[model samples]
Target: MDWLRKLFSSPVPLNDSYHLSPSYKVFTSAFDQEILAKDLERSRKYAGEPTASADRTWRELQQFWATDLALLQAETTRLAGRLQPSLNLPKSSTLTLLIDHSGSMRGDKIQLAAFVAEVTVQLAIKLNLPFEVLGFTTVEWKGAPVRDLWSAQRALSNPGRLCALNHVVYSDFTDGDHPNSLRAMFLADLLKENVDGEAILWAVQRAKAWSAGPHMVLIISDGAPVDDATLFHNDPSYLWSHLHEVIDEFGIDPDVLLAGLGINYDVSSLYDTSDTITVFEDIHAKVLPLLENCLRKM
Candidate 1:
């Protein structure tokens, strides 16, 4: 598995605008499907600690956000006490946030995500709901390493998803009670390409395994899937089409309730329950209402 990770994890130069030619897919190779084994699907995915030093990144958030976070905690406390119990989640339900850590989420978007994380924690605590804060991004900028590996094997057209899938457990269930768990969202370096379809599928699969009766997952992202490595080799709509398929398949399941939050991006196309993506500039953004709307289905 370490070898597999190395194959996909290595960074290399890539052409951003590379797209498949009409003839590219006409010709196929044995290596077209994957560069390695049947297990690349599992081996290429990572969900663990930040590649950077945790202590340093956590302290960075601590120093920069001490006052604001304190205020946020106080506000959440106030809201929790006054809010009607109807706003609380259904009992025995679990919540999970499948966030996009794409490069486009870098500056203000990422910062707001941390704020969202704080709010989610507050909601979980107030509602007595178990939750997880998870994120997804590629290991590197493009699929160059993956492509290079495939080329080394035998160049082929329509090779899907050359980059390593990185799913992050920024804060797992029960960790909401801990102070530093959300700090994983503050790591700027973890922000990279987003493959929303796979991330959503992974989150949904994990959530389904965790609970039988009720579970709610909220996907937060600023944009659609944009992994250059994949789009270049396959159809331009390859990832987007897969995203729609995954959502359409499980979005309406009886046991699971799913909603999407577009961070200033229009994700209404992806999730029928999700409205247009908006920034969390103020309480007026209806962030809480959206969460309430999703959980209401549960």
Candidate 2:
């Protein structure tokens, strides 16, 4: 774990291009498969069986044209006595994960954060729900502002894409050319800078524009908001005020749930100090229940 701190102590230049370095290959190969498998299994259980019901609309009747007329007519006549219309619940919630990769998250903290992210992503995929993963930290390195680590639009194209990097390691070394490689690097770099909670505002904007369904933002962090004065110099209450403004402007309420997963620290002070926050001294034991509880809330 101390090596992790030493590895990131010296800031490495950000690699904008998507490439998979040898270190990334080694890192992903070690952890991705097992994580993916476990997540997929859990997701399937949560997804349950797909249910089917009779379609009673003219739009559905169009399928009859594609069938053999004789067989279709016979089936239709046989089933004419028991035709009914039904609808299944649509997967309408979009899960947005906001992971804090600040300097404080080095070692086991970052690993657990990544693990939580993997599980959530797999569940979203199994439920056929759209999801986005984002990482936030300091605005700069080497005296210059850094760029966004990963965005929902850039890294995640679909649920299947999760399987593509299932064997890739999460690292910051720049050598290979792949989208997931960049993501791995981004997660690795979470340990490089201080926390900037204002980054959550950017995530909120993206969630508003990208998702049509109810949005759920789950933030995983180890500490309270920091770097506020650095990002917003005008108002001391900028973070809290801005959050309320966004909630009002977007009309996000019961439909939009904001939850936090605090590791080794209580982040409820950063939030409303309500049931919305869940603190864990360690994530290994309670991760599953934690995920399930959040899913239930949504």
Candidate 3:
């Protein structure tokens, strides 16, 4: 809860000068370190400079860019004609997007979350995937609230429409005395109050109704949970431990339901050297691949 509180309360300043840091480049995927070690040992005699955009990294980069829904849908449609079920499983029917607005993500984190949310919705529409859009912070709304972007196709047609959606969705955040901690608490409370739980429930309901199909949930965040003294009352792991139970209650195979976790472009330790881009890359290299591993195991 403390983690969530900090996320909500301290929104990052969007207008601040933005730059990509080199730290992101130095880091590698979960398989990167081992693969690099093996390749280095094999080629010790050659001593040639390594290419910047290796094949593996190029594939990941392609996947990242393909996340843009219109392009993805067009490509998928073109390829689906030649592909058999053995090679290409049909796209899932339902998708749930969860963005964590927790702790010090006020500026960059929030912006990215909102951007991804918009893309996820567009993809859902393009593929005719029934989808739910959810934003997680500690805040509560009346009734079982779900924003239906059924018209997401229409909304995404404009060039800068995604940015406008982000502004309105995140504008609800009010500046607080302890903005960082308060934001974290919002996310924490969301977990505690079963907001995410309810979303999971609806997802399972959809999956069961379809009988045999996959469901996806994509989560975007900078992994730090708020570590507030007062809000969490210091019991930090309380919510994370409940995540499995929440899945179990839904009666869905944990591994089959896809979950994509994205790390944002920010590093707390970047102050030492003004290389913000490097910091973001460093954190992404360390964290994203780790997260991918965990998701695969699930």
Candidate that would win on TM-score: 1
Give the TM-scores of the predictions, in the order they appear. Answer: 0.74, 0.48, 0.38
Candidates in order: C-alpha RMSD to true structure? 8.5, 19.1, 21.6
Q: Best candidate per lDDT, number? A: 1
Worst 10 residues of 1 by lDDT: 29-38
User: Which order, best to worst by lDDT?
Assistant: 1, 2, 3
User: For model 2, how does the per-residue alpha-carbon lDDT over 1-298 read when each residue is reduced to its tens digit?
Assistant: 4433433333233232222121111111111121222233234322322111111221232344334333433433333222212212235556677777566776556655654565555455445456766666542342121111112123222111111112112221121111132123123322444333334544555555765556677777776544432223223343344444443433445656667677777656544321222322233345444555555555
Sorted on TM-score, best first, the list reads 1, 2, 3
Please report, in order, the local distance difference test score of every candidate based on alpha carbons: 0.64, 0.41, 0.33
Off by over 4 Å in 3: 1-92, 140-213, 224-231, 244-256, 265-298
Q: Give the C-alpha miss distance for residue 75 in model 1, angstroms.
A: 5.6
Q: Which residues of candidate 1, in runs, are more than 4 Å off?
A: 1-84, 87-91, 174-176, 275-280
Candidate 1 lDDT by residue in tens digits, 1-298? 4554445433333222222122222111212221111122223232234423434565676578777667666766665565545554455578887778899987667766766777767777776777877778866677644655656655555666666666767566655474354555555465789878767766776666676748888888898799887788788987887677667767557777778777788777777677543454442355666766776777
